[model samples]
Target: MLTEEMMTTTEMILMTYLFEIDEWLKDKKVIQQQQAQLTKEELVTVIKNDLTTFQANQATDYEKKLQTTLTTLEALSEAQFQKMKLEILSWGPNVKHVD
Candidate 1:
């Protein structure tokens, strides 16, 4: 994901896959928002099963996504990680990086 260098064909394809993953992550968040319809007026027990299912699914999905992200990062050499040091440091704690 170097900004300065032109990506190789494989890198371009991988980038597309990463972008797709990012989009799916965003879309899943929306789905979660829709599913999490808690009301102050009334709480229902029926929602519990669905909520539990969603939580479990989301946790599993997140773990898979994290592993995929780690794979991309783990491919990078130390120099590459250094090149991305500033960007990684700039990110809040949620973003993972080698540095």
Candidate 2:
């Protein structure tokens, strides 16, 4: 019952709508890709920051351990020196001067 002209018009309208929808879909895909890229970049930044913080903490712990070791060694050396000096003094009056 439809005329040929009417059918041609209807086909043209449908094609136009299909083209618009395709363009919209392409734009949506591009937006999604951009968002995904931003998310990836943000994640990378966070990981780098976390790694930096962790390295700093490890260095601080190592420095503290080194300081403690050095302090302990210094204390031991001081005690040994005191004992040796006392022993030398106890040999008083009988110690020969080696010229």
Candidate 3:
């Protein structure tokens, strides 16, 4: 079981990471809406923007999954971190396969 100090440290780290991810996703969604109004050539100018947004969303989702696993692990003593690490790794090879 985590000492109070360890739990507090973990909570801070998790909160900061989650906040960053949430902000990134919000920014991405705004950019994506703007992208939706572009002409083909103009849209090409923002393709990288779109791709970055897509990746951000994917990362956020994976991080959320990891966070949930961590929370459960903290209480259950399961190897949640390692299991979530593997799940995160599996997503890397297929990142560009987005539709």
Candidate 4:
């Protein structure tokens, strides 16, 4: 029942709609890709910050442990020196009092 002019008009309308839909889809894809890239960059920054914090904490813990070990060694050395001094003193007159 459609005339030739009506068929041509309908075809033109359909083509316009299809072109608009295609353009919208392409824009959507570009926006999605940009969002994905931003998310990846944010994640990388967070991971790097976390790694830096972890390394700092590890270094602090190591220093604390090393200090504790040094303190313990110094105490043990002092106690041993005192024990040797007492042993020598207990020998009384038999031990020489060398300067």
lDDT scores of the candidates, listed in order: 0.35, 0.35, 0.38, 0.35
Cα lDDT tens digits, model 2, 2-69, are 34444333333222222343544454211223222323234234434443555653466534433333
Better of 3 and 4 by TM-score: 3
What is candidate 4's TM-score against the reference?
0.20
Give the C-alpha lDDT of model 1: 0.35
Pairs clashing within candidate 1 = none
The parts of candidate 2 lying over 4 Å away from their true place are 21-99
Q: Give the root-mean-square deviation of each candidate in angstroms.
A: 15.4, 42.5, 17.3, 42.5
Q: What is candidate 4's lDDT per residue for 1-99, written digit by digit as tens?
A: 434444333233222222343544454211223222323234234434443555653466534433333233233344443453333323322234343
Q: Candidates' TM-scores? A: 0.30, 0.20, 0.24, 0.20
TM-score of 3: 0.24
lDDT of 1 by residue, 1-99 (tens): 532222232232223222344644454211223212322111122223333544553466434443344444455665553444333224332344342
The positional error of residue 90 in candidate 2, measured at the CA in angstroms, is 99
Q: Which model scores highest in TM-score?
A: 1
How far does residue 7 in candidate 3 sit from its true spot (Å)?
0.5
- Per-residue lDDT tens digits of candidate 3, residues 29-68? 1122342233333423343343355465346754444443
